[model samples]
Target: MRQWTTGRERAWRLLLIAALAAPAVCFADGDAVTAKAKTSLNIVVGSREARPGKEVSVPVTLQTNGLKPAVLKMTIRFNPAYVSYVEEEDGAAAVGADKVVTAFELPSGSLNVVVAGFNDNAMNDGLLFNVVFYVSNAAPQGTIVPLTCPSGDGVLSAADPLAARLDVTATAGSIEIICKGPPAPNPVAGWFDAQEGAGLTWGESAGAEAYQIYRSEMNDPATAEAVTDWLPSTARQYVDASILANLQDYCRLYYWVRARNAEECASDPGGPVDFVINEIPDAPSGLTATRGHSDGVLLMWNGVPNGAEYRVYRSNNNDPATRQPVSEWMPATFSFMDTTTPAAQYGIAAGCSGRLLLDFFQYTYWVAARHTNGCESDLSEPAQGFRGLPESEAAGVLPERGDLTAWASICVLLMLAHRAWKTRKA
Candidate 1:
């Protein structure tokens, strides 16, 4: 074994010199004693999350890998703007060491830590010391303060027989200062599409830099968690497209929003707004279409539950895709008086050479259910009906129709009335 006892125990400087002067010693395995390793000095402050004016302990840990260190000295730097040093004890100076010395360079915001021992067990793996610090009361929230440990000059050595020199790599850590801000307001769940989920919106906070939305199956805020990490300040709206529509009011969801400021403080949640969902209405069934005595077709269907509106579709042929809504969305009712507007009347008959009055043409009709949220159901069973006419031969309704003489004049006036009818009911 390379003799370390021969050299009189001296200070760390002397030991370093001796270690440098010692010839490369080969062990029985023919391996030299000099084994270089990357050691680390880390600042671990239990939790990086901290509020202003709070005391936090920063543990200076050493990772020598498997190498036993005999002498370790380094400078631990901290940001004075966020934290200030607190303790000066041995454990706080140099942990698990026989001789401990620490130099406080306060103005420079650094702590020079030194520890050495002759016994091989001087410094094992794990923490080397602690630098207790109190978070500055004035520290702004969201500020990430750095705790860096830079390698001091020629300060680390192994406990090997030759006191092999080790390549020490120091790592840095951090402390975060957190604060609070004003809450968001007027959180609302505006709209919902069975396919697109819910649209959530909220009023802005005075100085908020960001926002977050929370959702839960239960009405309580405690059960709710953030749907997103955080949103930019400009984002006052979010669509929770992950939600499924409650067909039978199967389940209800609640939403809330919180604002965050530049200081990283999150305001109190704004609301427990109930999420609005557009449940898909059931298709209207049991449909029947019969020729009217005068100008339109009388159509009837089973009323749909939760159906805020209904749409009537008619096709000249059997193709479902070819069928189109004969009228704009209508109120939820079991029966509808569907009139054949001049637009449908002016079109030439399919088998006939000229335009027929459509008094005897058979049309396939269907009824669909629509929810207030715009979710629509499949079309109902088809029923056949003979010709019908416009409620009033208004000229404006048939603008797109071929304008020929008498029909042209009628089509012109009906357009305005038709648009107005569409704006209200079909």
Candidate 2:
């Protein structure tokens, strides 16, 4: 709040003493004159609320002893930060005041007013003059704008000889500056993709108790129908899985957020942000496998358009449910070499069946294209191929491979060696 003061406290007191020193009426020669009637003057101002950038009036009223007064004067001191003086006018034109002087000075925030009557009889009790003020837009909310008599002096006085001593009481007037309402929240726009869904996030508002998300398709302005239900203040983001799912790839979505305070006052919608749904690339096609001989199987596929990378999965059989990723993440290549060597990066399991058949291998392979935004397509058609020697010609030491070939190979090799040993023994 701006600090303001009227620096006339001492001077105001001295002036008030001088103005009230004389009895109500004095002779032309300055002889002491006693008033016939006792009278009082009151400065009345109503208390009210005022908005910034508006004009407000405070009336200074004079209540006489039912007798007319020949002279009157009023002075008002105020806080300049809250308001500025515009003008002042007589309380009633019918009374026909003789002469009136009004002066308003800044920095001191003071208004001095004086009026006199030209008629022979004393004037009736009524308004002295109204002081008009303009409430400043920068006025701090809840700050009071006061119009008061300085040092309780010069509030009201009369020169009517018929009136005796006058008793004056002054009441100060005040207008409180009330803020319009909740101010608009500053919103920062961004997108969020989480396990729950994809969405947009906005910055929080200082006075907001809740928020509403509004979305527009094709960059159009948002409508009420597109607005979400009021969300708790804690929710700074809104996710609608269906919106992204339903929209065409690369299409735009415009969105904004409105903040609401506890009083149900909602701020205007914030600026809009753009959100584009990205399309997932198609799965790689034309996948083919070749023999890697003793190493492993070699797999290749045609690159999918718009594919940022490719994911490879291998399975012992054609079933995808049995498939597991060959590596932790997708490789940025269309060709992958599945190897059986201990140092092979793909880490293909050497023993699929219980029997350890080192020579021959058959594997199923497929590929899926992945987008930069993490969107992935379905796996391509499975391809079956072989490497090394076929199962029928296999004649080597075999462990318990899951398939029966491992056991059959081990038994057949042992049988052939045993037959040769028997012939030699005979």
Best by TM-score: 2
Tens-place lDDT digits, model 2, residues 167-281: 2234335667665445555654667453344466777787889888776654444353455788998987767675545544433456777787775556777757765466667
Candidate 1 lDDT at 130 equals 55
Give model 2's TM-score versus the native structure.
0.35
Give the true-structure RMSD of model 1: 21.2
State every prediction's TM-score relative to the real structure.
0.33, 0.35
Q: Top lDDT: which candidate number?
A: 1
Q: What is the C-alpha RMSD of each candidate to the true structure, in Å?
A: 21.2, 24.8
lDDT of 1 by residue, 231-334 (tens): 88898788887665444453456788888877666787788777435366888889998642235677889988888888889898888889888878888677
